[model samples]
Target chain A: MTDPKTQTGSRQDEFEFFEESNALWWITLAPTTWAVHFVLAYGGTAVWCAKFGETQGVTVARLSIAGLTVLALGFIGWLGWRSVRRWKPRQNDMEDLSHPEGRHEFLGHAAFLLCIISAIGVVYVAMPALFITTCR
Target chain B: MIRSLAGSGRRLVAMALMMALAGCAGRQSALSPAGEDASWLHDLWIVMLVGAVILWTALNGLFFFVTRVRPNDWPERHANRLIIGGGVIFPTVLVGTLLAYGLSMMPHMRADGDGLVVKVRAEEWWWRVEYWPAGATAPIVTANEIRLPTGQRTELLLDANKYIHSFWVPALGGKMDMFPGRETRMTLRPETPGVYRGQCAEFCGPSHALMAFEAVILTPGDFAAWLEAEAAPAAPPATPEAQRGQTLFRDEGCGACHAVRGTEFDGLVGPDLTHLASRQSLGAGIMEVTREDLTDWIAHTRDIKPEVAMPAYDWLEAAELADLAAYLEGLK
Candidate 1:
């Protein structure tokens, strides 16, 4: 039988791996929100202009940039949510019992959860500013 | 007993401090004049506010009663009826009332009446006010400062030269934009005699934050005297220094941008310096028009305002600077 200490140590290592991966995944979501903001503002205006058959070259270019940005952000947000959804159950299972290495594993899981909560708060605060339209 | 008393005292102090901090904020906001139009739109704002308070109180009371009557451990009870009813009735009433009110108020605001009209043009930094008062000769042009008689209905015809800018004096009325090639009309009245300060609300450029002006609400007698003085051409300066400075002003390129009536300087690009001495402040209400400040402003316009279109007079000697200040002071 594997020693309880060694089993706990392995769980700690798994927890650390999950924590780092979670942080990295969430860091990638920031650029997506910024892109969504620009797309909503500039992209909406450009598409409306294009649908009316107005051939202004600069407007076309701005709209294309906005559309591409929105697509990129959507892709990144999907990837991040997918990874979090997959890893959350494993982290919860590890928290079922305490062992010699359980303390470190639990702490690492808490840190990763804190980061996710903080990221959600940041996005909520920035949503209004990013979506504000300044020009006609 | 002593520890509990001390704790209560500390809590009272904390509450008092919070109240004091709140009072300190927005003291200057009350100094503004008053809004122009009173309509149903304003009424809807009051109605919506009252409705929200009532709804919140009712819901909270119902929630408290239900929770107290039925414990959480009992068989699960659904609040779908309350949620669904509130979801439909709350937003529909709130938004619909506001939309109807706004639509009704828009037309009343646009209706023009037989009031004294003043044409106001917004340039890069300063406001050019033209008094087209009933039966006045060619509109009297002034900059930054506007003087009007109390208890008179005045219509402002606002126009912007370049970018979009907003004209707002919160005490009097809501903000109106000075859109390029479009004329916006705003009506205002001052019920009392006081000085009201206003600034450009829309972000225009680098100095946009600093762009400010004042509305001087004066008595009819003072307004008449001011108009008469403004109607007349600028009086010639008496002192030798002033005369010499007048000659210097002509020779220098100050004439190229600014206009001094009854002189060869007829450029209308800058502020009218015909009654330069009669003004309270200068530099678009940024600085007092003291002799020293005027001298510095004339010598280095770029120093006071970065990237200003007005060129600096680098060639003026000490004596010329002093004489010019004297001459400008004598314009009143």
Candidate 2:
């Protein structure tokens, strides 16, 4: 088998034109954004209620949540768009996925799908802000 | 004589289920709602249960058809669509819709309360409930029992003195937690007039399960009269035994923790015993408020509620115990 990452001294397919740097980081970036937003939303609300008491700073909390949600979804959307445009499917029956081209497509498709799911999660986490007006 | 084994097993299972379900209509069951919030929760539960049953039947029907009736694999032309639609799109849409529906009801579940305010402090293994009437300067204090009026929204401001405890009355509404420095609010608008049991939903200490209280939802007129009476002084002892028992009560130094109004025993560490005789139960709803239970509780305080700060009076003779019990029972 050829080297999976570099593909040195190996025959390359015509579709193998990928040149994204630090490619594996994109797979984890979307989920990490979701986690950060979740923690900040929960911890911020709890601290705000404990210190200021009954709905004292609810307006500010809601605004911060809305802004954070938009920022997170925008970053994930960019990653998803980039991955979808660069994605390439397997061509024939005899193609071995151990080749560099097949591996690249698999990673790209996986990151793209993860971005979609993470975006949904962020949306669900933020939906409560629309209904729950109080600090509770 | 028993019939076939399978038939006997089915009959036994049916009888067991019926016996289990018979316990659902009581003071603690959420299914038997006495308030508006609990009624809505019961309705939401029914809808969810029916939706789950329908989904289960449909999924199982598809499984049986695919596995048993159609053993041959379908053409590859339709394979990708079937895989994507069944595994991904169907679940995403279903869960998303359900989540949206659930979130939409969040604000209404904890709606604002505009009626009378009743502040409750959750102490170790007991409740210190105070009612703030419309034009009162100080709160009317009580313990181990809560009373609310019907046809109006009653707001409950919950807090804790030491450990984290939860105040839950299933027949009235949902549970609310109480922290030492923080306060949580919940509103209950009880429409039915009856007695219900409230318990500490969070496990706080050694006798957490034994920490419970009785809640009475009364008509507006009856509640007004009851509140007026609760604010007054304790009635004087009527019989000779009760009078001597009251003297023994003060001599034994029981007044250090428990308070009895209209007397010199003005303590604040434990429950108020001014109206002890009128209450439904004693020792935080562990036993009936009868002469026998009162005597046992006063003698065996530590045994009745473990880790409680109340001291035991086991050194007192049987006649002294009986007189003290009689005194407490006559404080109505």
Off by over 4 Å in 2: A1-21, A44-57, A89-101, B1-6, B52-77
Angstrom error at residue B275, model 1 = 1.4
Regions of candidate 1 where Cα sits further than 4 Å from its true position: A1-136, B1-78, B94-108, B111-113
Instruction: Give the best candidate by DockQ.
Output: 2
Top lDDT model: 2
Q: Per-residue alpha-carbon lDDT of model 2 for B3-24, expressed as tens digits?
A: 6888999999999999888776
lDDT score of residue B296 within candidate 2:
96
Looking at model 2, residue B187 earns an lDDT score of 90
Q: Candidate 2 lDDT, tens digit per residue, A1-136? A: 6567556433343234433344577688889999998998778877776787464757777888899999999999998988775455434211433566466666677788889889988988887776678766
DockQ of 1: 0.02
Of the true interface contacts, each candidate retains a share of 0.00, 0.61
Give each model a TM-score: 0.60, 0.88
DockQ of each: 0.02, 0.60
Q: iRMS for model 2?
A: 1.3
| Residue clash pairs of candidate 1 | B32-B171, B33-B171, B34-B171, B34-B172
